[model samples]
Target: MTLVSGPTGGGSIDDFELFYARRALGRLRSRLGRQGLLDLLAEDIGKGEAFLRESAGLSGGSFNVGATVLATRGSTAGEFVAWMDKAFADENVLLAAQPEHYVMAGQPDGAVHIVENIGPHVCSFYLGSWSAEALAWAADAEELLPEAEFPHKKASNLFLADGTVVGRVLIQFGDTDDGFTSSLTVYLPTACPESVLEHHLRHFAVEFRNWIVASTTARA
Candidate 1:
């Protein structure tokens, strides 16, 4: 997989890995056979759902991973936030957010169903609920009280069918003179491998960039 330099100075995944991950299913479709592939995916999705349901009753820690990006020119925090509100509320927009093996469905009840095909035999799926919050400003850490902050923030607390908190995805944005700066943080189970965490961070980078672009092109 090709590596792209991250905003925080670490090596991050490039479009190669993202593209490959989304196409894994297509690559194996012929070999698995249509029925065989469906059966396999159904079994996996069922098992994954069951695992989430059972694990919902248990409490465990998670590894916090995040990625930040700067969107310069032709965008503002307010506009992005408005776009997000509609995107999360509309199932079509949600489905169009990432476009392929990354499936997102926004429900009438305001929750989202997210599924990602990470590899030929592996998929990560979950149901989550979103909320808005106010977080302290990261740029003004030294000040006694940093008035400069990300005023627009939304976070999704990932859960199981039974409402057990499995993880969280926090998205925050602040307006800049040129455009806006946004960041996304994900909390996943500690048992998850480093590669999974890295992939998620890179996923954020790609997905959010797409959303930002969409926001700009949206009919006003």
Candidate 2:
């Protein structure tokens, strides 16, 4: 309810809004009771999922939203990814690293795709202009939609090479000299709430900056 549902310039996501959606949903579950909440979710799930394609434009608008975070100090992209991998490993979250898959029209085998630019100097929307990883990922763009599950919390998504939906993590990193200028983008399906995706993007930005600090300190 607190989300900037309409539109905003630069499309920056808010970390506070990210947490608010989850907390609000939790409160709704408490107030409505589990069954009540589940019933509502169940109803929306079928409708939202069924017409996901029809709502593609709307979802695309939602997906455009993003956030940026600066590292406390300069570092390599590998260091950033290392910290991210370990963070999720500790949480026991599923990961699909370097994910790829052929996208078929009209199938739940997979419905949508999202890209996370570790630190976005290059825009993913641009063809033949994105960073190396993005360009490499683009090589298969026509044959398949990169396999990825939108993460609910902070951490790079594990882009599934096998394109398996078994996991919901799609991690991508940008190879930046300073690492302080990294960025992330989430390509979400219409079935997923736009606001929630925005929330996740915010979480990803905040956590990434935090990891930068943690990793930097540990090495010092």
Candidate 3:
């Protein structure tokens, strides 16, 4: 696959990968057959959904899995990111924060779960520290995701009002016809499990909601 590199702000990770994957898949499908492509894609989608569900310990079995695949099939990276952003925002359980990149922090443990939009059908999780131990753990984990090695940058340690280390989100922005376009790159520790990570995300969401309620009450 050709790695298109320029300013990081030009597109999302999902958009890059999805565009290439879909194109390749399309060519293969045409040569093979539509049913052949659908069958292969269906299996890939199922595996992806299962991995997410098992790793994240999500209760609502594949709520938006189908939708996610459909949107990603032939869409642009920018378009997929928009849909993903909206989909994530609409989830009631996870408190969505686009601090810069889409970061969902766990309230109870203060662990930050990092998610990145890669093209239409691909998204990535930032494992903490990128240490040998962390990579090993991820390898042994239930979800089998493609891994990339990026150079590490010193991240500012951030704390919530409650004294949790949620880290900082870094977003790259570019000029687009839609106004300003931005994509988030998240920093997180590699030690967290999908279950624990998700739990913290839910806790943070609830806490944020409560804070909003309390502030509104005080104003009232």
Candidate 2, TM-score vs. the true structure?
A: 0.36
Model 3 TM-score on a 0 to 1 scale? 0.21
Ranking by lDDT: 1, 2, 3
Model 3 residue 195 lDDT score: 43
Model 2 misplacement above 4 A:
1-72, 92-179
Structural similarity to truth (TM-score) of each candidate = 0.65, 0.36, 0.21
- Per residue, candidate 1 scores C-alpha lDDT tens digits across 130-187 of 5432223223222112236677766566765556666666666778888887867676
Worst 10 residues of 2 by lDDT: 120-129
Off by over 4 Å in 3: 1-26, 31-35, 58-172, 175-182, 186-220
- Residues 1-220 of candidate 3: C-alpha lDDT, one tens digit per residue: 5447775666677777766764664455346443443454555544533444343333321111100011112223333334333433332223222211233333233234433222222122332332234334223323222222112211223333333333333322233333322233332333324343444344334433333333334335
Q: How accurate locally is residue 202 in candidate 2, as Cα lDDT from 0 to 100?
A: 66
In terms of lDDT, model 3 sits at 0.34
lDDT of 2 by residue, 162-204 (tens): 3222112323444444443454555554445556556656656
Instruction: Give the better candidate number (2 or 3) by lDDT.
Output: 2
